[model samples]
Target: MPGFPAAGPPGGPQRSSAETYAQVQASPEFAALRRRWRGFIFPVSALFLIWFLAYVLLSAYAPGIVNTRVGGSNITVGLLFGLLQFVSTFAIATIYSRFAEKELDPEASRLRAEVEDSL
Candidate 1:
């Protein structure tokens, strides 16, 4: 078997998953997507993080609203805003899904094809 060149498996040590992924990512479309992600990913994540932090801070510091009554029970602006975050998160997800499907998906598919072809 040593001299026979023993077969390991499909997609073996001769070619790793990372190598395959790298090849995929190396495609023109994915390269562009990566570049676009470089431009958008961190900024979007950071903005949402800051937004969440702001919500928490407002919840903590905005005393007048925190003590206020709504329909005989208390519902602070902070609480309202914080709860709205879930809605905002869902909205963001929907928007991102649409964007990715419409814009990124086709490009990614082309990239994937390039990768596979290279292999």
Candidate 2:
């Protein structure tokens, strides 16, 4: 096959998959890429979870607050908070897309190239 590695002689092994994986995992570029990914993902995930929990808790324990009118309008605090959830979700997606484009995509591409070359 064009892309597949050549088969070894009968009863013989070809390249070690473990060794190939270890080499890729051991690369400094791969390490840095992982660190950068986790650095952004963990904190953002925690923050969003906290924000969502807060909204849930407030709705469950303090209906009065959430139900309060907003500036004498038909809108309620709970309604706004629910809408804000959507807003925050979209905002986070946008921010992450930008982050990936600026901070992650290039490094990821390089790492992919390295892996392909190794293969």
Q: Using lDDT, give the best candidate's number.
A: 2
lDDT of 2 at 72: 100
Query: 61 in model 2: Cα distance from truth in Å?
Result: 0.1
Q: TM-score of the candidate numbered 1?
A: 0.68
lDDT value, candidate 2, whole model: 0.84
Q: List candidate 1 stretches off by more than 4 Å.
A: 1-28, 70-73
For each candidate in turn, the TM-score is 0.68, 0.84
**Residue by residue across 11-51, what tens digits does model 2's lDDT show?**
87766666666766877777888899999999999999999
Lowest-sum lDDT 10-residue window in model 1: 1-10
**Top candidate, metric TM-score:** 2
Residue 31 Cα positional deviation in candidate 2, in Å, after optimal superposition: 1.1
Task: Write candidate 1's Cα lDDT for 46-87 as tens digits.
Answer: 888998988877667876765566677667566677688998
